[model samples]
Target chain A: MTVGLTHFLILGTILFSLGLYTVFAKRSAIAILMGIELMLNAVNVNLIAFNRYVAPESHIGQIFSVFVIVVAAAEVAVGLALVISIYRDRISTNVDDLDWLKW
Target chain B: MNFSLLSSEMLAAGLGTGLLILGLIAPKTENRRGFGYITAFGLLAVLVATFFQYGINQSTFHELWIVDDYSVFMKQVFIVAAILVVLSAVDFVETLPRFRGEFFALIVYALLGMMVMASANDLITIYVGLELMTITFFVLVAYQLGDGRSSEAGIKYLILGSVSSAVLLYGMSILYGLTGTTTIPEMLTKLTWSPILVVAIVMLIGGFGFKISLVPFHMWSPDIYEGAPTPITAFLAVASKAAGFAVMVRVFLLGLPLEGAVDWMLLISLLAGITMVIGNVVAIPQTNIKRMLAYSSVAQAGYMIAGLMSMDAPGVKGILFYSMIYVVANVGAFTVATLVRRALDTDTIADYAGLGQRQPLLASTLTICLLSLAGIPPLSGFVGKFYIFQAVMDKGILWPAFVGFVMSMISVYYYLNVALYMWRDDPKDDRPVPVPGPAKLVIVLSLVVTVVLGVYPGPLGELATMAAKSLF
Candidate 1:
């Protein structure tokens, strides 16, 4: 049996679902950032699988995955910076505690 | 690489870098107000350059970057927004404890991101441009590091905004997997009605929805608006939102097969209906003016989405016209808020009492701006809404348009309530509110544009029509 696109696609779907769950369910800000990273990696898997199995001739999929990696890196850097500063200010990194502005 | 076509972008990039370098060279004791002047003048030069390039359409770099009327018009809008924000933020920046030069530099960088976004013709460029804009915004939102409210707002925006971008990237990946291309026009060829495509489209909408603050995705905006500095809030409300709509229009109209899926229309219409209803309804109960404007901005985005439901050139034109009108009116309103926030050190609606008696010009300007936002006649918003509803009417889709019309009426009450508070009630302290010269110029400029375009909308209306037609 040979590995195929469907198998990779299914794997991507599961990873994406887990990421989505973590983002919505996590209370810690750091945990939320990890969830976002998880989601971006799922996208990378999808891109690589498509590039290998579907369009071997064009490198658009592979190229896009690299872009995603760079973006995710920048996002995490900023996210962690924000969380640390908020921690410094409030002594906690919990999402619930960040709610100073409410209706 | 046809360098001439990218002259405006290059100019912006150069200015941003120059400002950063200048900040390093300038003495630490120097008044940073000079940085603000440099940025404003640089933006004004870019605006004039963009205006001069009107009607010369071209595409370069394998058609991945476009230079058309639509992008040019959108570029002009972003430049105007940046100029207004920089001007209004001059005094406000002086009040901040640190990072004054970096603040102005980041603003110019963000403007460049918007310019690129407006011109992006491929998914990769769009993603990059959007991240460039959002990352700068995350910093801008959290610029007051010592302020807990600012840091919290920044974190909220960072988390939510990143999640939305991840979702959008997932959707884009799927679209790429299916189509083997990222260029929007080329992708249109491979698009078909498949379950995967359906999921992709849904994800795309969800991602863009968060950016435009359409109802469910709008949770962060009010908090961020209330927490971030008022100028940044105004920029987020006007330039950022406009950039989102511009990219949305490009992607949805050009990339997706709107004609293939009537379900997409239903989906967007539902979002629009709920967004307008909730945004306006929630705004009524808010006492904080910044948060109130946040909800009101959400509702305004809903009206623009309503225009998109028509899915025709006129509908797109309606969005274009309405977005321009919105930038002027909403920025005017926010500038007034900034001035009021500075004077009273409060944002409560009740505290605005006796404004009409004390600072008659600011109060009256804000009233006119709010009235314009409420879609009152002889104001630009009235004509803007009329165009959108007319386009929706042409589609024979009466319900969403009807919902929009009624919601506009509900919106009028709350908008006028602010006016009533200003004119009717007495102030606790009857001290005078000082209006600085630069901020006063911004207010008067926006006021003039609002009233002028409201009365004679032909030239701008024609330009919007052309821009909308170019996309199709």
Candidate 2:
């Protein structure tokens, strides 16, 4: 059976749902970073899907998806660095403790 | 849509790579000021290249990046603003303990993103450029993460900014679903007001709203501005924010068939009203100069939003013109704030007491900045305000114009509080030191241009008109 747009979207939907779950359920900031990564990858799936279905003839979405991957890697590096340092300072990676400013 | 890549992107990219390499190769003790000088030269060459590119009537690359009068106009503004920011940061950045080449490199990266954003005609390209900017900013804010405030600022920005991006991405998906295209002109021909696309508009506004620090979505701004280095704050307030505005204008005008335009205009008008009211009123009670200025930036953004919503020749032109004025006035304010922070070791308004007596040059220049920011006559701020109001009046938005006028009046109290502390002879401390020549030069140059622009805005006004016409 040929994988159509809905099939790709269903896969992306699963990835996005998993990402949302990671964001809400994870205590570690790095875990949340992973979740964001998942979300972006899901976006990539949708982009390539659209490139396949809508344009079918052009690779605009695929090209953009590649750029997105590079950006996502950069984002993860910076975010992890921040999380590591925050963990060092506060000695906890739980996202809940970040509420020192919640007056 | 491929012409030669904008020289701004090339210069900024070259500078970033050079900084990364130099950061690895250079000795720790060598004069790091050379990095600043090199970056300044890169931006200057880009500035020259932008004017040269302007000779072409229209240029497009890959159907996603377009260069016409509009983007070229903003390219010049962003480059000039960035050049002045880097020049003024020489001593400020040098003082940081762990100053590496990455600081300047990230700045150039952010500027490249800003230029790309200004020129982007594709939703995907705009998203990439915006992310590039926000991520660089996430680092630039916490460059001094050893400090608790800096770390806190970074965290705040990250959480809020991430959510905004997600919403924006979702909005992009909706737009794609609706129009089946990410290209701006294609979407313009295909835009329809389904329930989903309307929701997408809201999401898009929320995303851009965070960057611009407009009301109801501006919570992270004051903390981040205060925590970041002053030069980055200037960049955030001026360039990155303008870059967001650039995309907002393109999407609403050039990227849509103007359907649902009225509703969006009304919504933006309401946002402008609240932004002005909240920004001015909240600033009155803030003791921290940076925070006050941050709120004031929110108010100034409201004026620009009003200009964009007006959607006429003058309305669009006014937004561009006022943005130019804001770059000068805001950088001037931040410059004085940096000087005073050096002198008094605090940003508290009380620290400014008897500044006129202690250091007349610094105090007077700061007064000029404050007055201009308050929209008093014969300063660039006044001209900026007048142009925005003229646009609103031209659009016949009487209620919004009234709100804007009233907010401007309320704004004067806080701004004058700054001046009252400056020029008042209540010597709360001992004497002051002489201003450094470079810092003084920034002040004098900004002040002189402020006066010149306010008195004769015709030339710049014409440029704004021409720039706005390029949108169509």
Candidate 3:
């Protein structure tokens, strides 16, 4: 039961694909935020894995992972606030339905 | 890190934060918002100090940041932009009443990011700086959360922006894994483009693509620009865009080292051409002034890319020159838009129908800015275009140059429409453009600089040439 480089990359690709699917499939803005969170986590996992497997001598990977988390938290906090306000104004978080601007 | 005397940018950041504190304590000043003056004066001081300190430190902060002509030059642009933006923003923020201090403080924070990027010698530093800029904007974009369009634009940007950042980070990790370091100079020299390195490079470019609003990743810009507060839009249209150009030139030329690749040049040239064409052509139909500027910003960005595609010192110089000119034309344009809208109390093309008769100074300034933006001669915009075209000619990219030339022609049609509408009389206004003192001062200053830079661009051109020489 050992995690390898390929395994980490596979996990990352899966998360990325899931995030992409969430962006495309989900109509709710909050759901899309989750997808972004997942994608960021995916990158984090890969960074940590690479640090463990590929470059344990340096701690930069872990540092980057921390940055991703910190940034993600900030993003989600503001994002959720925005969604709440948008919902209050428009009565929904559906992305497709939110189009007041069109040609 | 001069502990005794910090670089003025750092000083400005401290002052900006202090203002934020004061603003929270006392939201209502008697006559005018004191924080606006504080922010503007602080930035002017920073601008002066930043130049003196620019080349003083070749390698400071343990060589993590490299400050040279390039960084100094870019900082000059950012500082100037901050001052002008603050000047115009004074009137706007006074009306908002809620977060004027925070707004100015966030701008300082964003400037801090640009400083980091300007001096960042490593990918890790660049990423850190880039995030600082983006995170601040995450709130700034959605600052008007009460407005649906603003919220939608902010959310869209966050979602898409986060994805691009992740993809870019993945690229960074892969580069680190393959090259064993995230230091850009090291990676540039050591990288041989293994499968992993190549993938990382692509991801890095994609992330930058999003930031610069290059084509596919550009979907968020128009929305975000229209959604953000007006001053923030000015920041995005000028300061943020300059930051992108700064990093792009550095990372592409100094960090990545994609040399001797004709195919790469061809790809970039094609992208530049199409972006120039599409951004302008598509903008013709937009009625929202903010959104129109957003599209125009995209097209302007394409011109910067054209500079990069040249891949020579002159090409680099072209990008620098274009970036400088762009800041002048765009900030001036947006400032006028904000001013006129505030006066007329409307934000539609129709509202501006009788602007020429109403406010001669404001309307005429708008006309000058629009003409410059359209690449008309004797305006800074034309000088910028000339440099880019000259660089392309040097590189002998006939098709791309032809396309850009024609695209500029197409742009004139719509850019002129602003003037046309202002003069044609839609029966919307006989009130005249209200040229406030501050607004009048800014417009006068920008108009002079735009024209001066256009006609006798030798000095500014020299500065950009020096930047090109250093970076390239």
On DockQ, the leading prediction is 1
Off by over 4 Å in 1: none
Model 1 Cα lDDT, one tens digit per residue, B1-472: 7878889999999999999999999998987998988999999999989986777778889878998888998988888889999999988898888878989999998999999999999999999999999999999999986989998889989988999999999999999998888999998877877888888988999999988998888988999999999999999999999999999989988888865642577788889999999999999999999999999999999999999888889999999899899998988999999999999999999899999999988998899999999999899999999999999999898987788889999999999999999999887898779999889998998888888889999999999999888877
The CAPRI-style docking tier of model 3 reads medium
Name model 2 segments beyond 4 Å from true: A1-28, A94-103, B260-262, B431-434
Among these predicted structures, which one has the highest TM-score? 1
List iRMS (one decimal) for every candidate.
0.8, 2.3, 1.8
Order of models, best TM-score first: 1, 3, 2
Residue B421 CA displacement from its true place in model 2, Å: 1.5
TM-score of each: 0.98, 0.93, 0.94
lDDT of 1 by residue, A71-90 (tens): 88998998999999999998
> Where does candidate 2 chain A have its weakest 10-residue lDDT segment?
A94-103
Q: What lDDT does candidate 3 reach at residue A31?
A: 91
Collision count for each candidate, in order: 0, 6, 3
